[model samples]
Target: MSERYEYVPHHLLRRPVRDIATGVEGELMAVINENVSDAGREHWIELAYIRRTCGREFTTAISNVESVG
Candidate 1:
């Protein structure tokens, strides 16, 4: 049998994050899978930031999650 998951609103999962070094605000895109690890979370944050900022990708070390909203 296959497992099913409930859908969560994008707005609810979109978190307000900031670049600690540059102070640029951005969104932390949410993870849909429940089995994500700490490293995976970090990678997702970086990918989301890059996609959102385009060529202005921030270093993973400098991005910080401010709030989930």
Candidate 2:
């Protein structure tokens, strides 16, 4: 089962879903995409959330997720 997610602003969460899904879905449809695994994909989604909420450096933000968890 998936872990519970905390609530977030609608504007913050909604944009990334639409934004990331657009690229993800397009790649899935064409079937030519490469370099992103399922775990990597999930990380990117989380990265979007990090970018939206923290406005910090992507590499730095991604590194800090381990501390949060």
Candidate 3:
């Protein structure tokens, strides 16, 4: 029997995420896309969010996600 997995899109996320590079925190706005390697060993995803400090929007990958409020 084949195992089933749940797929959750990033755009639907209402939680906050911190950008690893910029150390910026914001609430998720949208998920641009998700990519997986051919071997299915690696994953890459891009997302957009609004900056909490200045109300600016930015798109980035490799961010740290925080629990939803």
Off by over 4 Å in 2: 1-4, 12-22, 25-69
Model 1 lDDT, residue 49, Cα: 37
lDDT of 3 by residue, 1-69 (tens): 122222347643656767667767787666554554456465545555545657787766635444344
- How are the candidates ranked when ordered by TM-score, highest leading? 3, 1, 2
**Per-residue lDDT of model 1, residues 1-69, tens digit only:** 122322323432345666555556666554232222353342222223312455354433322435423
Alpha carbon lDDT of each predicted model: 0.40, 0.25, 0.57
| Lowest lDDT block of 10, candidate 3 | 1-10
Highest-lDDT candidate: 3
Q: Sort every candidate by lDDT, greatest first.
A: 3, 1, 2
Task: Output the better candidate (1/2) by TM-score.
Answer: 1
Worst 10 residues of 2 by lDDT: 25-34
What's the true lDDT of residue 41 in model 3?
68
Alpha carbon lDDT at 12, candidate 1: 21
Task: Please estimate how well model 1 matches the true structure, expressed as its whole-model Cα lDDT.
Answer: 0.40
Residue 64, model 3: lDDT of 49
Off by over 4 Å in 3: 1-8, 34-45, 62-69
Give every collision pair in model 2: none
lDDT per residue as tens, model 2, 36-55: 34543432222333332434
